[model samples]
Target chain A: MIGRLNHVAIAVPDLEAACAQYAGPLGAKVGAPQDLPEHGVTVVFIELPNTKIELLYPLGDASPIASFLEKSPAGGMHHICYEVPDILKARDQLISDGARVLGDGSAKIGAHGNPVLFLHPKDFQGCLIELEQV
Target chain B: MIGRLNHVAIAVPDLEAACAQYAGPLGAKVGAPQDLPEHGVTVVFIELPNTKIELLYPLGDASPIASFLEKSPAGGMHHICYEVPDILKARDQLISDGARVLGDGSAKIGAHGNPVLFLHPKDFQGCLIELEQV
Candidate 1:
C-alpha cells in the first residue's frame, strides 16, 4: 500500500555545499535541517512548492546513506517517501506482497519526528521507498 | 531549479495489473487512464491525497518505455516530474549547468496537453527528472 509522497530524498556529498548549490538556483531555501542519530545522518529539508526535497549526507563514511552514495556514484533523487496514516498496515501489506522491510517491523521517528520505515530497493525495482506515518 | 513535484511516474510491466495491485490495498482506485501516443504510454493516474501517482506502461514493445522496462527488472517508481510555470527557462538553466537535454529544446504538450520536457538522468545522478510546465 502507498500514500501521499511525503518527500523526495536527495543524497549529497556535503550538506552545506548541497544547500548552497540549491539555494540561489531553485529559489528554494527553506531549510529544516536536523540530525537523526539513530539513522546516522544529517538531513536538510528544503521546502519546495508542492513537495519537500530532503538533502541527506552521512555523519560518517561507514553509515548507510554514505554507502548508498558511494555505490550509486552520483547525487540525485534517492528515495520517494509516502505518508500513510497507518504505517503498520502499509508495511504489512507491502511485506505480504513480497516486499522486504529494511527495518524491523517497528518504525522509528524520522525527520520532524514522523515514524518512518524503509522498504528494500530490491523489492521495489531497485528504487528505495520510504513509508512515513503521520 | 526544482519545482513542485507534479507526479511521481511509476513504470510497470502492466498498467492494468499495477492499478489493480495498488487499488484495494492502498485504499486507492481513482483511475484517469489516458494514452500519450507521442511518449508511447498508457498512463493510469491514481489520485493520492497529497500527490498523483502515474502508472505508465508502453503502448508497444518497440517503445522507449518498453525498452526501459526490459533493461530494468521490476515495477516501481521511475521519474519524478516537477511542476514548473516555465519549462523553457528551467531547461535552459539546467542545460547551462551542463545537464543534457533528453528532449528537444521546445516543450511538447504531454498528457492533458501540459508542456513537458525530460532531463537526462546522467546529470542528476541516475534519476530521470521531468519538468512539467503548468
Candidate 2:
C-alpha cells in the first residue's frame, strides 16, 4: 500500500547547477549527493520533513533517467516516490495490477541511503513511480 | 526562503474512483474535499507531514489542468508544490527569470484552505508548478 509521497524526483542536466539554483534562490538546503550505481544515477536531495526534491543525473549507460531526459526533451519532473511499509509486497501487487517494473524487485540504497525500487513509466500513465521502504 | 511541500497535485478524471482506490488499497485517509473556483478545480487532499497528495478534477472548462489532461492524454504527475515563505516574492523572481504564470498571482484558498498560486508549465519545461504560502 502506498503511504505518502516520499519525494518528487526531477531530471537535471547538471546536478551542481540545479542544486545551486534551489539552494541559492529558493533557499532550500541541498543534502549530500549520493551515487546509486545500480541505477546509474547520481542523486542529490533537497530535504523536506515528509517529501523531498531529488535532482538526478545519469551516471552511466543503461540508466532510465537518461532515456527520460531524451524523450522529455526538457528537464522536469520525472517520478513520484511513494512510501510503502512493505516494499516487496507493494512491488508484487503493483506488477500484478499491470504496473511495469523498471528494475527487478531489489532493495538498493537510494539518495537518503534508504531501500528503493522504481516502477516503469508505462504502468501509471507515463509517470515513473519509485517505491521506497521506510 | 521555502517551507515544506504542501501538496503534490495530480490531474484525475474520476475523483471518487481515485479516492476509493487510494483509501481502499493504500490504507490512507482522504481529507475533506474543497473546490477552488478561481482555479477552476475541485481538489481533494491526502494529508501528510510537510507534504500532501492533491487529486485535482476540473470544475469548469477554463482550468489549466483540463488542457493538460487533453495534451497529455494520460493521467500522470502534473506538478510539484514548493512551500514558500513569501509567495509574492517567489512569483516575482520566477517571472523575471522567464517563468510564465498561468494565474495573475492571486492567492486563492486551495484544498487545505491555504493560499496557493499556479506557475505556468512553460516556465518549468512543461511541468506545472504550484506555489503555496503556509
Candidate 3:
C-alpha cells in the first residue's frame, strides 16, 4: 500500500531555469542538481513542508526522459512517487490485482537510491506512478 | 512563498474507475465524489499521509477539464497546488520575478474554498501550478 507521497517528478527542458523558478519566485528550498548517469538524467530536488518535487532533465542520449521531453517540448509532469513499506510485496499485490508493472517487473535503484518500481501508466489513470520502499 | 503541497490534481475521464484504482489496487483512502458546479468539475479526493490527490472529471458543458480529458483520454496530472500564506503577496512576487499569472491576475475561490491563483505553465516548467491561501 502507498504511504507518504514521496515526490512528484517533472521533466523540464531547461533544468536550470526550472530550478531557478522554484527557488526564486516560488521561494522553496531547492537542492543542487545531481547527475545520475545510470538514470540518464540530472535531478534537482525542491523541498516542501510535507513532500518534495523533483525536476529532471535528460543527461545523455539514452536518457529515459528524452522521449518525454520530445513529446512535451516545454516539459511536463513525469511521475508521482509514493512510499511503500515493502516494494516486493507491493509489487506482488499489484500484480495480483491485475496492474502491470513496468520494466522487467522488478524493483530497481531509483534516483534516491531506494528500491523503486514503476507501474504502467495505463494501469494508473494515465499517470506514471513510482513506488519506492522507504 | 509556497509552503505545503496542498494537492495534486489529475483529470480523469472515468472518475469512478480512477477512484476505484486508487482505493483498491493503490490502497489509498479515497473520498466520495463531490461535484463542484462552479468549478465545472466533479472531484474525488485521495488522502495520503503528506498531501492529497484530486481526481477530476468534467461536470458541465463549460467544464475546464474537458479539453484536457480529450487530449489525455485516460487521464493525467492536471496541476499541482501549493499552500501560500498570502495569495496576493505570492502573486505579486511571482509577477515581479517575470512569471505570468493565469486568469485576470486575481485570486478566486478554489475548489477547497480558499483564495487561489493559477500560474502559466510556460513560466513554471510546463506544469500548471495552483497557489492556495491556506
Candidate 4:
C-alpha cells in the first residue's frame, strides 16, 4: 500500500532553466543536478517542506523521458511517486486489483537509489505512477 | 515563497472511476466528491501522509479543466498547488522574476477556501502551478 507521497517528477526540456525557475521565482531549495545513467536521466530535486519536486532531463540515448519530452516539448509533469513499505506485496495487491505494472513487472533502481516500479498510466487515470520502496 | 506541496490536481474524465482507482488499486484514502460550482469542478481528495491528490471533474459548461480534458481524454495532471505563507508577496516575487501569473494576477478563493493564484504554464516549464495561502 502507498504510504507517503514521495515526489512529483517533472520532465523539463531545459534543466538549467527549470532549476533557475524553481530556485529563483519559486523560492525553493533546489539540489545540484545529479546524472543517473542507470535510469537514463539527470535529476535535480526541489526540496519542499513535506515532499520533493524532481526535475528530470533525458540522459542516455535511450532515456525513458525522451518520448515524454517529445510529446510535451516544453516538458510536463511526468509522474508522481508514492512510497510503499513492501514493494513486492504492494505489486501483488495492485495486480490482484487488476492494475497493470509497467516494464517486466520488476522493481528497478530509481533516481534516489530506491527500488521502484512504474504502473501503467491507463490504469491510473492517465497519470503515470511510480511506487518506491521506502 | 512556496512552502509545502499542498496537492497535485488531476483532471479525470470519469470521476467515479478515478476515485475507485485510487481507493482500490492505489490503496489511498479517498474522500467523497465535493462539488465546487463556483470553481466549475467536482473534486475527490486522496489524502496522503504529507500531501493530497485531488481528482477533478468538470462541474459546469465553463469548467477551466474542460479544454485540458478534451486534450487528454484519459485525464492527466492539471496543476500542482504549493502552499505559501503570503500569496500576494509570492505573486509579486514571481512577477518580479519574470513569471507570468494567470488571470488578472489577483488571488481568488481556491477549493480549500484559501487565497490562490495560478501561474502561466509557458513560464513554468509547461506545468501549471497554483499557489495557495495556507
Error of 4 at B46 (Å): 1.0
CAPRI tier of model 2: acceptable
Decide which is better by lDDT, 1 or 3: 3
Error of 2 at A9 (Å): 0.4
lDDT scores of the candidates, listed in order: 0.76, 0.75, 0.92, 0.92
lDDT of 4 by residue, A36-124 (tens): 99889999999999999999999999998898889899998999999999899999999998889998999999878789999998988
Native-to-model Cα distance after best TM-score fit, residue A125 in candidate 4, in Å: 0.5
- Candidate 3 regions exceeding 4 Å error are none
| lDDT (Cα, tens digit) per residue for candidate 3, span A20-125 | 7888878899999999998899999999999999999999889989999888999999999999999999999999999899989979998889999899998888
Pairs that clash in candidate 1:
none
Every candidate's chain B TM-score: 0.91, 0.82, 0.96, 0.97
Candidate 1 lDDT tens digits, B22-88: 6764567558688878788889887877778788888855667788787765765678787878888
**lDDT (tens digit, per residue) of candidate 2 on B1-134:** 66778777777767786677567645567877688887788888876544678888788779867887787756677888878777788878876766666755666776656777887754454467778887
Q: Each candidate's root-mean-square deviation in Å?
A: 2.6, 2.7, 0.9, 1.0
Question: Least lDDT summed over 10 consecutive residues: which range in candidate 1 chain B?
Answer: B21-30
DockQ of candidate 4, scored on C-alphas against the true complex (2 decimals): 0.84
Clashing residue pairs, candidate 2?
none
Q: Give me candidate 4's TM-score against the actual structure.
A: 0.98
Once fitted onto the true fold, the runs of candidate 2 whose alpha carbons sit more than 4 angstroms away are A93-100, A120-126, B93-100, B121-126
In the range B52-110, model 4's lDDT, one tens digit per residue, is 99999999899987888898989888999999999999898888888899988899998
- The clash count for each model shown is 0, 0, 0, 0
Q: B73 in model 2: Cα distance from truth in Å?
A: 2.3
